[model samples]
Target: MSEELGMVIGRGFDTWKRNIGIAFPFVLDMLFSGIFFLLVAGVVALVIGIDVFLSFTEGAGAVFGSMEAGENPQIVEIFGLVELIRPYIGLLLVAFFIVVVGWIIIR
Candidate 1:
């Protein structure tokens, strides 16, 4: 059984090596999308104003208490910023999906 498992693992690696060209584009697509998301999120944060964003942090702190104090974390308050950018979330996801699909098709 151990020898059979080793053979299976070796075969999987061989297959992956053979398909590196096909896999590389999708990997680059994922990296590019992540950077794109961060850039867009930064712009959204700036548009919303630093003071407004800080207010949300303050509210989160008040509700969740300090993480260093070992209190139960209240994550919902922290995620409130998501509500502000909710409209763009779907569009970003759809764009990412289309890019990934296009890469896969082209590959």
Candidate 2:
């Protein structure tokens, strides 16, 4: 039993070692996917302004307070989002356009 197990393990190890090169494309895919994500995010942030994220952080406390007071947090969040985004609809549209173009080019 012990000898048989050792042979099985050895064969499995050999098979894995021989096939290790096949994993390179997956690694490269992940690398490029991450790079692509960062590139897109940076472009969107540049277009839409980084203040959008900061505004969410700054307003979270008010949302949480409203939630604790028995208000629908989702509605509060939605309204708050609308308020923040209303002024930037044009910029957001531009960001969306750029991202779509970038995605088409990358893909």
Candidate 3:
């Protein structure tokens, strides 16, 4: 590497080592926030039930199966996937809203 590039890289490392302490609080905050959101998501997913997920997976399987066979999945198959997800869209939206509210409150 060139001399100028080496110096810059060394300085960057030194700066990061000196300032890493400043990042700890932000890292911890994100960790806690992620945990909070995951719990909220779990509760929301429970309320949404397994049936929707099963249907979604089934539709996805059909799409993947076609791809695996080197075929472009037809529009109808894509529509089937969308149809499976359509009914649960509202529940998913509510879950997202709840997570957003929780994030705002935490922040």
Candidate with maximal TM-score: 3
What digit string (tens of lDDT, one per residue) describes model 1 on residues 1-107? Answer: 35688889999999989999998999899999999999998997687577566666666565555555675455554554455456557767987999999999999
lDDT of each: 0.74, 0.81, 0.82
True-vs-predicted CA distance for residue 57, candidate 3, Å: 5.9
Runs of candidate 3 with Cα error greater than 4 angstroms are: 1-49, 57-72
In model 2, the runs with Cα more than 4 Å from the true position are: 1-49, 98-107
Give residue 25's lDDT in candidate 2 (0 to 100).
85
The C-alpha RMSD of each candidate to the native structure, in angstroms, is 11.5, 10.2, 10.1
Clashing residue pairs in candidate 1 (N, C-alpha, C atoms within 3 angstroms) = none
* TM-score leaderboard ranking: 3, 2, 1
lDDT by residue (25-97, candidate 3, tens digit) is 8879999999999999899678666777777788788777767787766765777678777887897898899
Q: What is the lDDT of candidate 1?
A: 0.74
Model 1 TM-score relative to the real fold: 0.35
Candidates 1 and 3 compared: the better one by lDDT is 3
